[model samples]
Target: MNVKGIHHLSAMTGGITVNYQFYTEVLGMRLIKKTVNQDDTSVYHLFYGDERGNAGTELTFFDFPGIRQNQKGVSSISGTSLHVRNDAALAYWIERFTEHDVTHSPVIPYAGRNVIFFEDPEGQELALVSDETNSGVPGGTPWEHSPVPAQYGIIGLGPVKLTVRKPESTLAALRLMGFTEKSRIPALVAGQEDIIIMQVAEGGSGGEVQVEPRDDLAIARLGKGGVHHVAFRIEDEEELLAWIEVLNREGLQNSGFVDRYYFRSLYFREPNGILFELATDGPGFDTDEPFETLGESLALPRFLEHQRESIEDHLRPLVTKRD
Candidate 1:
């Protein structure tokens, strides 16, 4: 089965309010869903994306207040790259970042594309890549209330960078899951080895994954402001289950099949220890609420409905900042 592209990338956050403010007010993404982690309902599971909360556009956060800062090193998803329209869009983001006092690096070239590196309030690494030639997936809609104009708004997720102790075993696992090695690029960061770019069928922004060898670094500890898992898009349940079969056949352990309400998911860690997930794209954010009122209120899956009151009381109230 062909994995289409990125489904969504989920990360951990130290402060939900700060995360909400930066992603919504500063970055101009819509808070498309306000829900709690299904496995552990005390913490918030916030989903931010385009107006419709499309698959490739979603960037989710699991709020764990007062959690220890993640120790950055090998065996973790080090950064997430977002695609922009072109150089003009990159300039717009630079200006906006300056205006908001968000710390960011100067535009840098990697793999022949111009990119600006930055971090979220909680220190999750992020980048904006300019790819004028590539038009993203069809039917993506921009958030109406976004401060950034639609033309220059972030198109979707770009390649996710993973810091691994070694690339050989990880590359083998990725190939088993249908990723093809594209090219090897010089490391943009000091002290790191070369970067290997891989992609699914004819990859675009959300379809690419970068593997960076960082054997000298320490093993990463999962905590606040660290990536939990990188989810790649599958067409539907059929494709999702097929991947489970493939993983099992190859003797790789996976989460079997998990129904995440918005999407069905199967999760497993690559040989280097970076978590990966395969997620379906349908029954999306609009399942519980209409497109017009998405993210307007706290939403819970049917199983959690019984504890809605308790969950609401546990989570701090979040309000979107709109112009």
Candidate 2:
């Protein structure tokens, strides 16, 4: 079975308040889930997405109290993208970013699409891509009450950018996973000159990965403003099970059949040390919380429910409610 497009991206953040304000108010995505990191149980794991917290729309973050800023280099998820419906949406964002005093670049072309690359307050690399011509995998619905108008709101995730040491090694692993080499183009990404490699499934932006090969940089140091992992969409649990075997058959050592509560997952690392996960799309954020009151309170997986009090003990309060 083949995989779908992007599922969600988990990243690191140093502070919760500023990060929350930037994503919910500035970016205008809904805070769909307020939870603690299952692995650590001490830090906040916040999820921002479209109104319903759809699979392809989640951009999640894990909070670490005093982490260092990310050292930009090879072997990192260099950039994350958000999909907007058209050129007019991009224009609206340019104005909004300016009004908010957000640091952003003018619109530029790369790998057959026009995107406006920008950075969050903590130096998280982000792009707003124009989906005017996208016909591959579709984007999700925008939050109706988003500070940014619904018509120009950030819909779903776009292509994820991976910075690796060897292009061939990363590309080889991708081919085995069903991604096709769509196009390769050169562009200045975050002030560095490198080749932007596009690996995609036909014309779907969510199914795309922009891989940059750089021989002149050091391995990235993970901290605040760094991507922890990028998960690809597996249409169902059955396909995810098949992917477990596929990854093993390809000689890749992976975490086989992990039940993430919301979805099942399989985790592995490609040749370049970038973490990748194959995840099922259903049993989503709505599973534990009702649609109307999503993100209004802290949510925990059933497995973590018994320790909710202890987990809540370590959490620092940052009000997650919005208008």
What C-alpha lDDT do the candidate models reach, one value each? Answer: 0.85, 0.87
Query: On residues 153-236, what C-alpha lDDT tens digit does candidate 2 reach at each position?
Result: 988999998888787788887777778877766645465445655545554678888888777789999999899999988788
Where does candidate 2 clash, by residue pair? none
Q: Using lDDT, give the best candidate's number.
A: 2
TM-score of 1: 0.96
Clash number for candidate 2: 0
Per residue, candidate 1 scores C-alpha lDDT tens digits across 74-169 of 998998988887888888889999999998998888776889999888788899988866543432567876888998887678889888988988
Q: State the displacement of the C-alpha of residue 147, model 1, in Å, after optimal TM-score superposition.
A: 1.2
Candidate 1 local accuracy as lDDT?
A: 0.85
TM-score of each: 0.96, 0.96
How many angstroms is residue 291 displaced in model 1 relative to the true structure, after the best TM-score fit? Answer: 0.7
